[model samples]
Target: MKAVLIEADTISSAWSQLIYEIYKNGEEHKPDYSMSTRRLHATVAINDVDNNQINSFVPFGENLIKKYKEELTEEYAEWYISLPDDDKRKFDYCYAKQLFRYGETAYNTLSENLKNLRVGSRRHVGVLWENEVHIPKFEDQPCWIAYKLELLNETDVLLYILYRSWDAYGGFPANLPAIVEGFKKVFREKKLPYRIESLIATGWDTHIYESDLQAVEKIFKIAQLCPKCGNLTPKHALISTTKGKVCTQCKCRM
Candidate 1:
């Protein structure tokens, strides 16, 4: 498997670079289904996750983030809270259940682990893929596998994410933010005195589908223009320009 390692100042920047690298150097291949692309195995590291620097490369904006947050963490109040865990393994797999809402959520489990952690402990981890449940079925199985949080010091935590496969265009953008946000919630609720030190994401198969090329090009264009505005463009909006890049509301005034 070919490899690409990207280190960027922000998650959006890292994601953009990953897409561009895959576009340029990814090997062409066919997938199990119709949509295919030049793909590669890669690991991405974002030193900082700017709440404001969400990438224009993503096809949609914060709404996508909201959707993913619910899917991955079920953070919203309107979520299906009463549904029982499937006993027969006959129901289709739901990633959120495996991650945050089954008998014991990954967040719940990790919080317990962190609370009991010692200064030099190595057990801060959460898992989303279970063999008995996922191995029997194929639909809606999780692409994200597991994550680990390592306490580096008294005031910082290092997060490592593992994805069995990732869709660079849509899934990754949503996955990264939702996971980070979920961690923040856990840390805060647990009252752990730790801030995110760094985030490292490893994906086995990361690729852009051929059909999404037009949207990808649009994102690249937006990334190029951000520097003109001091990089303050909102995470996901159909942006326009005045003297420089501005949000649609700002553009409306001009």
Candidate 2:
């Protein structure tokens, strides 16, 4: 088992560093399911959740942030997860709604407790997994397992998260911000003065799918067309090509 720890001031910075770290050092291991992916474990801590500029890096629609943000709430979770047991079997994928909703939602419990804003109370925790409904064999399950908040002071709230599984490329970016927003909502509803002091996320199995390898390479590639000569060169290099010495900018390349 390999462990990676990343600490950054913003979600974007943390995400960028973690991606590069995994690409450089992650090991390849076959998952239980038939998928082209390997697993790695890492812990990431971000000091600023409000600075979410890294959302731009997500190839998918930015709307996914909103969608994931909703998923962190009890209302959305309850709406999607109210199906009866027999009806739940009809769905192929197990939704997080089941974990966050139908079960005793952590948000509700946390909100109720925060009314008093008691510091150093270990009870400021929320659970997502239910042994009876989830522990039994199922095709898919929620990757996020639980969340806890520690009121370090009257104005600082520290968040801690546990993930049974994590997708570094796609899931990590969205999940972190959304969880922060979700917790912020809890703090706001309680009318308590608070700042997201710090957030720590731990993943038991974090990985990227093999199918996305090429996309990852392109993201970090340094080669780009020389602005002047139109010849490909390392983005930051002065290259001596048949066309002549090409600089990073058009005038030098031309």
Top TM-score prediction, candidate number:
2
Best by lDDT: 1
TM-score of each: 0.76, 0.77
How close is each model in CA RMSD to the real structure?
6.0, 7.4
Q: Candidate 1 — worst ten consecutive residues by lDDT sum?
A: 225-234
The digit string of per-residue lDDT tens for model 1 on 150-204 reads 8787887788889887888777788788878777776787777878888999999
lDDT of 2 by residue, 1-254 (tens): 77999777677666666666667788887877856655668898887779643533455776777887877765665655566767744454333454344364334455555665567876677676667767885556667877777889878888888999888888888888777877787568666688789999999988878887677677669544333433334555756666655654445425
* Model 1, residue pairs in steric clash: none
Residue 189 CA displacement from its true place in model 2, Å: 2.4
